[model samples]
Target: MASEAAAQMNFQTMEHPAPMPIDQRTQVLLTPGFGTQFTDHMVSIEWSDTRGWHNGVIGPRHPIQLDPAAAVLHYAQEIFEGLKAYRHPDGTAALFRPEANAKRFNDSARRMAMPELPEEMFLEAIRLLVEKDNGWIPEEEGSSLYLRPFMFASEAFLGVRPAKRYKFLVIASPAGNYFKSGAPAVSIWVSSDYTRAAPGGTGAAKCGGNYAASLVPQAEAIERGHDQVVFLDAAERKWIEELGGMNLFFVFDDGRVLTPALTGTILPGITRNSLITLLREEGLTVEEGRYSLEQWREDATTGKLVETFACGTAAVVTAVGRVSGHDGEFTIGTGGPGQLTQKMKDRLTGIQRGLVADSHGWVKKLG
Candidate 1:
């Protein structure tokens, strides 16, 4: 059954008068670097206390008009989600676990004290945008149409309470490789000074503020010549939490794997969950519990930890070849993509591209 929000709203399409030329679009698609290139159209839905969700639109991408004193600008009430629309082998597009992304978006909305968008409406919004801009879906390997769905408080007010009005939008970007360096494996810098989230905080939420707080440390990592930053627990400042925007997984030499438990401080990642399911199906024991930075260093030094990788919607599965912090630096395995890491990436990407059977029913084909 369709939710009230979905049933009450109908997306009105507004075609672009002067869309990008086909040759230019094709050139951009050939080398769409990350989020640099956008599609012709986007999806939007407005919400208010009185109107609920109405005025859904699929129109040309344009700048938004937000009041200077909007609630989002003042109180930082914003949430967003990231997923991909992959072009399958047979010239069809499919989304991987979009329902999961919708659920997580609502979870972030709840944590941020915003209105929950109905799952039906959320999925429909993405579908409308993806279908409208299907040409923007990249055909090359390691490229796809990256979808960003976000909601922000739009009510113009200067108060601490939740806003009465909101705007939800979905945008598409033709993305190639996430890491521009083209390194076989990424190097991570440990953030000793700053922590991402603590217990009873918004660490688990996919809000803009959480990411806003991480920019400084992320910049520091870049300055130190690393690809990404990893944060520890805010309370103890020892237990490994996650990266700036990804989840961590440690593979052991004894055919066991471990990831930091979801203790209300780590974002429950869809890719992380999918990888766990895949690992378990391969008859490997995957544990989720507290893993300290000290333990990571010790295990890598003693060869107990053979591989470490980060997972997220954008990067998928990237091996952590090297780790560095204020204390020192250490290499994981051979300081390159591990055998299992490559295997996992191949299997996951294979399923995503429809080359392998999606036994888990995760692929939602949109023809």
Candidate 2:
């Protein structure tokens, strides 16, 4: 299988002579704001039809040389994954379920008609980057090194079929908090004018096109003074799908939690999955099925829906305090983070930051 091939390829490390100065880097790391600051180096691996995968290198972060007719620029054949490397309280670096990211990345590749990378290769690339750029990881509470691993078609020919050549790279970012509000909750805009994905479309795939299609609606949400945009099912435009970049969850007054079922149109979020397991462990009745926006409004109005929140790698878990659209607006649970929402966020974040016991074996400690 592809995994067997990946085991044979050794990652070659290249020297990066000019790293950021200690004083300057320390200052930047002290107040690193999300993805705005990057580390000194990166990891890259090239793939082709004739060679499978070759020319692996961990070197200085630099501008990539691409052909004028590169397939990624023209056809947009690209996919990416996001996860964080945590600096534990014990002064060690670790990752949360990175193997899960590798599996999802390959799933995205299969959907995009791209080559499947070996899981071992994916993990090794991440390990290499986290180790090389160890200094970029912020030690402050709620801050970590964000890892972005992406692949794109690089063949120069302008053909309709999949490109024979491809490139996979991993980069790191020092991040603090994703939301600038620093509030216990976030506001959402119901995007009735724009739909993120359709049935049997690339919605399930974590590709660039799915995000590209959401930018306009997301912009509109921001213009209307919302933190994020909530999308409805493309078919009926009635049932809830997810947020622009995260998955939605609804908690009931009766202690039941409901999230949209994966109907091949929603990104299967790792954070969402982890929270589901954690909720179930606490004996919660978790339901994965269709939940219409009308039902959401009715439940919130009648005090049936206790809380609403979204989950992702970047935001972790954020409560949905307000919802608005062209139809009207509504508030959920006094327009603030509910008790359960805050509890869930705290538990998940605790496990990720290595403060609490990791019973699920999700944390992979690094150097």
Candidate 3:
């Protein structure tokens, strides 16, 4: 385990405050609903044109000081990544596909006109923080230590150019499942009003601006009594895209699974990728291609679309109950988790928790 993890991410421990003992009750809150809280410690590193990346620190959680004129504020030069620390039954803690997060972080940085963090440094930051605050790891079912790593232009510049100074930091949240309210099916509002990205934009990169852009549309969906917003293609606004934060998947009654082709406008969620892999392993046929809104609605009405879901680090695999668009509303597959969706979720979670054999060797044990 160590060797495989080392090949992808190297670690350097940073000392921090002594961990506080977590009571059984508190631990119960940690897992049941995962990411609404945080751990006690955080990891950070600084970067500049002259000094480069240095002054690594893993310490008690605290607010960071930022200049009012920082480049991140003026130009919106920022990027972020998310993953989790899962507590195994053996009292050990591990991360699922952390190296993938590190790689995505670099991709975001490049797109945001910021400097990239080394793969080793990114991995080490999460490892040290999770280990230091090992007590904060929730022991509840589905609970995890949500690790957020982000970088932004920290230089106090006024011009509209990329700043050479930046800071990278990782904060951990003790997360419950994203839908603390319940695991009930969620409704999505189809948004043909706004475009998430253009062809040459930061659509695929896990950056802050994309999320910032999603806030307004998401608010509209909520106002309309929907749980989330789904976007269509930018140019045509006819093809199905993805949710504001998660990737979309469709299942057919005949057992064919399909997700949008990576057209550079959709975020390649780690969970989405994992599901494709796990399903294929179970002898399921998976398709990655464009599925238009008209085609989807027609299929659902004709009983072809059996299940629809959104995938992300926070939600894992959430069943999509209904899709409401400006034209009309289409309820999908009795608006519940389908047999295939549930089975895929179980298999993916099994691999994450060490409950099943990891054929792909995705788990990276931290201890």
Candidate 4:
């Protein structure tokens, strides 16, 4: 099997002879902001249509050389994934729900007309990088090693078709809290002008274009003094979609949880999925269906919607304190982090940090 061959593939590692000194590395780990500090090494793998995957290498982190006519430069045939490696209480490293990331990466590849990597190879690549960069895992309370695995077309051709060659690489950074506001919760700006994705588009794919398309609206939100932007559906521009980089969830006063359904225009978020499971475990009703901006405003005004939050790999679960739109602005439940929001964050972080029992076997321990 192709996957079997990839599993047997040996990675030649060339450790950095002159890595960052202990003192500097320690200082970086102390206050390393999100995606600002890097580890010493990375993983690289090459693939071609003729030979399949080969040349697995784990080498010192450095710049990548690309030809001027590289397909990715022109066509943007690329996909990426984000995950984290946690430092357990016993000093061991673990990954939370890595298999899910692997699956999503392949799904994105499929949608982009790129080659689908073997799931085993994806998992192995992550393991190799984390093992070699073991010292980079920060021990800070809310800090971890952020892993970014990405693949891009490498063929130096200008044609608008799938490239014959590709490269996959995994890099890591030690990250702390994502938000620097230090507020109890975050504020969102509803974008009535721009939409994130449209039907039968690349909305479900974890590719770069989706995020690229959201930058303008995000800038508008920032200009308006909001923390993030929440986009509406492209078709009608009335249905509630998601945030610029995260998924949304609404908590009602009657113990009901609702999130925007995935209708080929929403990214199926892993954190959102996990929280749905956790909410069900707590005997709460969870619904994934169409929700409109009008309904959101009405609920918030009538005190029916008690809390709202956004979830992603970087931010985990962040409470949406208030929402501002073209018409006006309103607050959600005291304009601060709600009780259910804190509970979900605590339970999830507890499982991740090994402070609680792993009932679902979501934690994969690494050496």
Candidate 5:
């Protein structure tokens, strides 16, 4: 049924009239700093209660016009997904685990009470945009085209109910390394005053509000000279849930790994899931269970916990070198990128960029 609906949903293409010149684009791609530079084109689709999903367009990247009373402006009915298009060695482009992203996008929509987009339709939108703007993909070693697909309530109503109209848009950004600190590993600051999500809240949803609620704490972390902020469970305020925008993992000395269980709060990260599979395949014990702040400090101090890392789509895999909060600071395994962390990052990135064989068939090539 979703394949049938996707086949019927046609996208009208309109090329950019005055796209960026080749030389200028090359310069921009040379050092495309994360999300600052954008591609020439974007994808847009509209949805409504009566019309369903219609009016699909692949056109120039432009500003979005919204009514003053739009529900998204007030109620924050928005959800989004982030994935990347990698330029392989053979001059071809591919996406890693895009199907996972599509599924997660719908999951977020379901949680936010927004209309679910067909998985096939979601992939089709991404394919159209990537193919149309293929030239924007950076050829650098660690660079790719970052794709952001987002949906929001477009209906101009002040009511407290779900909006009847919605709009979905996909934009491409030429991205480089997500972190600019050039540190061997990133330092994290534990947030004691602010929590990311409650048990029945939107923590698991990739909505704007969850991130908005994290801004103050994130700023506080930065002010304290940390790269990222790690949040604790709202109820206990001791169990480590996740970082501001990534997931956590603890590597132990006994060849066992543990990540905080997804208890309706932590975002089910695709990178985190893939790493678990890879670790288990490598004959390592992987466990998904609650890890507390007290336990983390104790294990690190006692040499039980050797390496800790954070995973996500943007940062891929980054080791947690130092942890600091009101209680004090502690170092994890020489306070540098651990050997296991580097190995996992290399393995994951190798599979992503086609340097290694993809036995899991996670990469979807755009031909």
Candidate 6:
């Protein structure tokens, strides 16, 4: 016999009702880092070609069961996204431009030969999860609940084609700040031997493969006393691409800001896009063009490169103190976070944490 709600929906809840105490939660909220600790509950939903998306559930945060021959395991069919859930001054929980992440998540899904999840469903999952764990949202300054929404192929198949089954999950972690010390002028190492992306590759998408390719070169840069590594174009190796995890920005001496144009290679970061808007609002001329390392070194040495920095979802806006290469190196504008970099970081984080007015409607309230 079919039940009355069978025509409507199916639901699931946690069998183990384990939640952290207020003291424990306070301890985590006070600590600061990304991907460090998880909340009490997480949201999970299933999808398959045969049945589409279904089986939504909110349960205790725990490890996922995967088959030995899962498609994601064998073929590496996986993608993920990162954003934050902020606790506002009025005692409300909110998210910053979650819909944008939904669109980007689908963008990654299409590029990775995976099924596209509906944008509403993606946002709904975030809303559901954050609402359930509202207590986990941190109230400290520069702190938030870092929301990580990920999807992967769950089919236990040996084939090379796209998997028929998929799993989408959202987990929240309380993160204080991405930069341990603070956002200051940092150093960048120019990588000549390795490039981040190639033509007609997974460069534009936020996939694990691109990050994996950057680790070795990034290690080289870190060993050489640098905080980050910047890549040149794959073909000519002249035009700037981006950093290992952030996007580059250059401030000309003439009061003009320039970032590398999106030429189907660089990742269109959310923070990058936001900065473009924030700078223009402050009555600054920002340009998107191909910036060369040779010119960067020359300009920085000659004081034409007044300011240099990076922007990303993780760190927001960070100042670039210097750019160093094998042959030569140059310090960017007195080797500290420039005036513009500091102001921009302040404005962006201000809007995110509700310290300033959100005229752009980028924040989505959760509770």
**lDDT of each residue in 1-367, candidate 3, tens digit only:** 4344335442344444555446743754545455556666777788889876777777777798999999988899988999988888899998999999988888888877788777877888888888887777777777788889988889997998999898888998877778755756899898888978778899999888899999999999999989999988889988888999999999888888999989899998889888888888878899999999999999989999899988899889899988897889998888888777788777887778778778887999988
Against the hidden true structure, what lDDT does model 3 obtain? 0.84
lDDT (10s digit) by residue, model 5, range 1-367: 8888788898998979999999999999999999999999999999999999999999999999999999999999999999999999998999999999999999999999999999999999999999989999999988899999999999998889999999999999999999998688999999999999999989889999999999999999999999999999999899999999999999999999999999989999999999999999889999999999999999999999999999999999999999999999999999999999999999999999989999999999996
For 64-139, candidate 1 gives per-residue lDDT tens digits of 9988999999899999999999999899999999999999999999999999999999999999988999989999
Taken over the whole model, the C-alpha lDDT of each candidate is: 0.94, 0.93, 0.84, 0.93, 0.95, 0.86
Tens-place lDDT digits, model 4, residues 38-140: 9999999998999888899998999999999999999999999999999999999999999999999999999999998888999999999999999999998
- Model 3 segments beyond 4 Å from truth? 1-35
Total colliding residue pairs, candidate 4: 0
- In terms of lDDT, the best-performing candidate is 5
Looking at model 1, which ten-residue stretch has the lowest summed lDDT?
1-10
The CA lDDT at 272 in model 5 is 96
Candidate 2 clashes between residue pairs 3 or more apart in a chain or in different chains: none
Which stretches of model 6 miss by more than 4 angstroms? 1-11, 181-183
Deviation from native of the Cα of residue 136 in model 1, angstroms: 0.5
Q: Which runs of model 1 end up more than 4 angstroms from their true locations?
A: none
Better of 3 and 6 by lDDT: 6
Among residues 3 or more apart in sequence or in different chains, the pairs in candidate 4 whose N, CA or C atoms overlap within 3 Å are none
TM-score of each prediction: 0.99, 0.98, 0.93, 0.99, 0.99, 0.95
List candidate 5 stretches off by more than 4 Å.
Answer: none
What digit string (tens of lDDT, one per residue) describes model 6 on residues 62-119?
Answer: 8889889999888888899989888888899888888889898988899999987778
Model 6 scores a C-alpha lDDT of: 0.86
For all predictions, the C-alpha RMSD in Å is 0.8, 0.9, 3.2, 0.8, 0.6, 3.3
Q: Model 2, residue 123: displacement in angstroms? A: 0.2
- Tens-digit lDDT track for model 2 on 1-367? 7678777788888888888998999999888888899999999999999999888899999999999999999998999999999988888899999999999999999999999999999999999999999988899888899999999999998879999999999999999999987887889999887899998899989999999899999999999999999999887889999998999999998999999999899999999999999999989999999999998999999999989999999999999999999889999998998888889989999999898899999999996
